[model samples]
Target: MFAVVLLAHGDVVRERKIAAHVMKGSVEIRSNHRELRARLREAGSVRDTAVEGIVERLDPLGPVCTGVIDGGVAFGVRVTVPYVILGPIPRETFETLDWPR
Candidate 1:
């Protein structure tokens, strides 16, 4: 459960209703969280721990995003029409991604 900032055209808005999932110890995905989790794990991260976080269902439409940890901050992206840029949290609170041991 976390907030996601969605960007479209030229607007940045935070979405608190959406879901989030820890894809690994470094990445998290939001929007269609469950399907993405299964898909992500199928792609690689097939560890015993599965995935961490909630799978909040969202209306399937357009515009989705993900992020990662870098230099103690979340810094990653999803290349699309407007090119979505993701987080660094608040420079204080950090997301503890769950990974299999």
Candidate 2:
């Protein structure tokens, strides 16, 4: 599945807002042209399930809140396209990120 990562210069709320819009069918998550509404419903907390999973890896750095929207087709080729919102915190607060080494 494809992953959309939005890095904003604003606060956490902005990140959440973008995530919400992307998740709520506002922004197109993928070009596959499949409706992700059903997968999202089955995933329970989209934010917690997808976004938080990524955020957990960044916890050691600082406080970074996340939101996610699922996108993909079902059947045997089911994929969970994740829309990730990254909150910007103080540089000093984070010693390092889970970015590429």
Q: Which candidate is the best by lDDT?
A: 2
> What is the model-wide C-alpha lDDT for candidate 1?
0.31
Candidate 1 Cα outliers beyond 4 Å, as residue runs: 1-29, 45-101
- Using alpha carbons, what is the TM-score of model 1? 0.19
TM-score of each: 0.19, 0.30
**Model 2: lDDT of residue 17:** 33
Candidate 2 Cα RMSD after full superposition onto the native fold (Å): 13.4
Best by TM-score: 2
Candidate 1, residue 65: how far the Cα is off, in Å:
34
Q: Tell me which residue pairs clash in candidate 2.
A: none
Residue 16 miss distance in model 2 (angstroms): 29
Per-residue CA lDDT of model 2 for 1-101, tens digit only, reads 12246422111112213443334433443432344444544544653455566766655544554543334332212334344534455565544435576
Could you give the C-alpha RMSD of every candidate to the true structure, in order shown? Answer: 18.5, 13.4
lDDT of 2 at 75: 22
